[model samples]
Target: MKGFMLMFMGIGHLYEAFAGVHILQYMYGCSRDDETEQTERFGQLGYNGENFLEYDMKTLTWKSRKQQAHFMQDEWNSDISRLDFWKNYFSQTCIDCLKKQVDKGKSTLMKTVPPSVSLLQKTPFSPVTCHATGFYPRGVTVFWQKDGQDPHEDVENGETLPNDDGTFQKSTHLTVTPEEWKNNKYQCVVQVTGIKEVFIKVLTESEIQTNWEDPAPNIILIIGGVVALLLVVVGVVVGVVIWKKKSKKGFVPASTSDTDSDNSGKGVQKT
Candidate 1:
């Protein structure tokens, strides 16, 4: 990112020297990274990515922090951290710059339109927000949708922002449904009066899955039932065989005693 910034600064200087113009641009990360550059107009700032030196308010002066810090401590302040610090600084700056531009751009667009204009940010998924802005947009309205479909569930919402030039800015948050967004194209449509509407579509978060899984439990239950049925059949067969064997082994002595008693009594009566 530092390299990217320096490259822009160099270009800005060249443009300023040749174009005789000073472009008013922002210093996004430089202000946040080190206070020194924030105070110094050593280089021309960029708008989006490219730098037009003529637009620079500082005549596109390019200054290196290490070379310009008044005190030795300030010169090496960036070195106090590790190499990763520089890497992080650049990434953070890029992200900040990108977000700021989008947000600012959105706000600027809202103020220029008429009243009660409903600008729909179209996407393949849900919109993050619904915000619209205009000069007298008291009657102006904002609406958002996913591929012209009504939002099915929760969606992130955007707000309408008025720009400095009497224009309006509004951003719609389109949530990327992993299932749908990949194959879909989302757009933000700015519907306005006396002007061609605009469209801005941004990628959103992917849909999440909360369903449960696992088929083993049912299979295990089926196996256990089959095993229990087999055990029951085997147990009944074994019990029947044991009872039959015991009945055959018994049934003896009681018969002999009964026969002797009856005979003896009959003889005595006859004598």
Candidate 2:
């Protein structure tokens, strides 16, 4: 199934409580057997949510179709609209685009790489995540299991979302208590179409690493060490400068009269 809409809005034009030019909408659907379905081609001319033209591939006819040319009110007029012509045009265009996309897809092989599974315990609850990425043909199933049995009622299944690298990823979360952490067994299981085997892993605390663990303490320690070294160097320099200044101004004790008398007595006795 495919759909396309092209709207042309004149300046200051308003429709459906919005200002815009609504024009040229197209949609198409195709399958392995084209005969099995109807309403394959549908389009709307205005923004009023009314079907402009719809074609049934089974009956190959147009029913209750309306057409609106540029800046014109919608009216049911198939005589001048030529529904068959537009139907063939949209069908051909869609089929050609589909073929091109299919060819491009065929060039790349479809494969499934098992997800990297991890278990996390965050205070009140524990969550197990299975990141299955870089796989083609996006259909995948990821779920959780308790002990050796199927998923329990308490399990929460997350939606399968696309990744930036054109692959798909999904996570299944299960809440656990502290008691459950020590006593219960939990695992995350992954299954994809291309791979025949199912991937399974038991949840473990060792497998989970918190990305938010702070490095501020280590950084502060490094800064403190640097500051302490600078302080020690400054203290040593200041002490050495003061000691040198005191040594330059030497302390000489005053010579007293007693020393002179002793010297004179010794000289006179020798004479």
Task: Find the candidate with the highest lDDT and give its number.
Answer: 2
On residues 108-209, what C-alpha lDDT tens digit does candidate 1 reach at each position? 434344433332333433333434454333223344456776464555555656677656656445454557754654433455543445533333433222
TM-scores, in order shown?
A: 0.23, 0.52
How does each model score on lDDT? 0.45, 0.59
Question: By TM-score, how accurate is candidate 1?
Answer: 0.23
- What C-alpha root-mean-square deviation, in Å, does candidate 2 show against the real structure? 8.2
Which candidate leads in TM-score? 2
In model 1, what is the error at residue 212, expressed in angstroms?
32
Question: Candidate 1, residue 187: CA error in Å?
Answer: 2.8
